[model samples]
Target: MKYTTDDVHNRVKKILYGLTGITLADNKDIMISNRIDKLKRDSKYKGDIMDLLHLVEEGSYVTEFINSFTTNKTHFFREDFHFLDLKNRAIPQLAKSGNKINMYCSASSTGEEPYSMAMTLLEVQDEIGKKLNASVIATDIDTNVLQYAANGVYRYSKSSKEFPEWIKPSKYFKRRIEKNLAGEEILIKVKDELKKMLTFQVMNLNDNTYPFSKNQFDIVFCRNVLIYFSAEDQNKILKKLFSHLKIGGTLYLGHSENPQDLVNYVKRVGQNIFIKEKEAF
Candidate 1:
């Protein structure tokens, strides 16, 4: 059962695109086959990749396909400047209005980015000596990652990569050494205070409309995920994200992403950062 045939690969690609609107490049054929192989082993589906694709097309094991295909590579404060800007510039200006600030981490993979947002807001609150009433909604299409995010635990070794050298992990996380059946391992967990600020949910960004109310978010972090989409889909998602943002709200994109079609609606303020025009509404 060779699943690397062009016909089988195209079938799998069509199934993925239909479900998630992600366009797979031809070079990704081997990558897709590898993911499907893992899925085959995990699900114990004693069949070839074509069988898996048929099951996916029949709406069976769809969630597993999505969880397997969607990329979830992220770390806390992966982009340092974004958090700095949020803490020093965005929070301060928004705080001056004395209103609750709403934020959406649109692709909160494994909880790092959303937790980073919480930490930044908490730091600002301590500096101002007042509650910012900041609330964060973290959403991702991958339910498996969402569950891991909700648990808020990670290997200390890996989690250590979350912050920049200047920031200390102890400031935001509580570290503990615990012995398991395997061995003694150090684990880092998100502090309860920071965990309280985030609400995690499963969401598909490919939807025509998001579940959020209009003009709801002050900041939307849809970083790193747009590169997987086509230009038309990227513009479509950007337009939808704009509609969800409040006037003068900010949008953060991945470093490699540029909102070519969205410049009319949002003014670029920083590298891969844009502010919704006050007149956008």
Candidate 2:
């Protein structure tokens, strides 16, 4: 059995933060420690807790550690009103130009949020009797989760169960069946239409410069992630995200995030939603 002490936990936390600019909140040591212990057991790592910490500090097995430590909690139609706002408010305005709509979903975990955006785009275009020609870029720091997102499969008990009620899921998803030597498994898979609308990539928000061109995205969703950073870091990230938004593009943040500091650059258009400001559009 493997166990981690307070010192071990602190060192492990520091290692993960240094690698991913994402910090665990206070009082999360128990959860971090448990995951570390699980790693030790699963890998059958011979090193004790402190020894394992040093290995991680020296950048050995760092990717696995980072993958295990990062939080990737998300679901379809999360913060439902954001998608509603997209369908009823933002998309219509964006569709006015008859140009392709571009959306960015940062910290997109396992595809749900971006896919939700795709579903909304599909729904709105159908209602208006026009193809908005929209696209979604879904990004995350965890390679493991990104792979899962690109695969576009979800368990029936989890997100798949909720897919049907949203718009017309049949247009975007299909039943997936799998058979293996060990056993059989069943899941729902995203159809090509939805997959074609999304491009999944590995992105770390901590980078000083993002890969996106300035004023590139028509809608941005950077939800449920700012809580992990310091206030200063949060401001830095928000400014970068704002730079990527077109003048009238909408930005959706986590419900618990504090965006009061960004008043100079953005105005609140809805709950936890802001539109970039230039005083022109």
Candidate 3:
């Protein structure tokens, strides 16, 4: 059955608002219809459009629907320059400050960004060794992806091939001795040293209560996740992120995201990078 663009928009608006507390406006007709068509094809729904809408409207299925519609296109070192900045400037500066350094990867999907962060810290291990305490908390809303992240393994053929060999799991991780019931080999082993520095958890940015402390982090990498949020939500999240950073902590956004004249506490540093003003805390 065919759906008018309005039907698609109404259905999707209800679904998104229920699942994410996000309201997709009525103007999003074409985009919503396109997304629903894709979802229909992906889920193999053989019935009418109304039936598909029913599936989406059922609140129990919204999480899977959100994951299906959301984009998760990250790879090892997708933002290469940020790592360079982290190595040359961020970590070095933090080392001398005599503070425990906590960095958060707020939208870490599939583990590449946080693991890449671990690798960068290892590169500067000699200078940063024991001078600065470090911990990385990687959070995402999708539990399926979080499991993959917690496992710290990837299909080397997809995202890891372009990374230098020294950072690949082969340099550190040994193949796990156990197999899933499928009897297929799992493809990763994170070195004990790097693995110790990172943790993965499920966090929903839309929630009113954050699980972390205020003024607690030295840096946060919440990239590529804000594009889906409305401007109002983005502003709210920026404020929340700022509240969690120390006086001079830094916040990194995706190349496509901007603070839109909303934040005064963070000053532009490098491209797509912002440093919290020393006075903000």
The top-ranked prediction according to lDDT is: 1
> What's the residue-level lDDT of 116 in candidate 3?
86
User: How many Å off is the CA of 144 in candidate 2?
Assistant: 0.7
Which window of ten consecutive residues has the lowest lDDT sum in model 3?
A: 157-166
Model 3's alpha-carbon lDDT is 0.75
Runs with alpha carbons beyond 4 Å of true place in candidate 3: 1-5, 21-58, 127-132, 158-161, 164-169, 175-186, 278-281
Cα lDDT of model 2 by residue, 1-281, tens digit: 55547677778778877887788777997788678876786557886778777887887877678778888899888888898899999999889999889999999989999999999999988889987788999999888899999999886554355654557665777977787785766677999988999999988888898999989999999999888887888988888888888988888999999664677768888999888876322
Off by over 4 Å in 2: 1-4, 41-44, 158-166, 177-186, 279-281
- Sort by lDDT, best first: 1, 2, 3
Better of 1 and 2 by lDDT: 1
Report the poorest 10 consecutive residues by lDDT, candidate 2.
157-166
Cα shift from native, residue 53, model 1 (Å): 1.1
Model 1 Cα shift for residue 6 (angstroms): 1.8
lDDT of each: 0.86, 0.84, 0.75
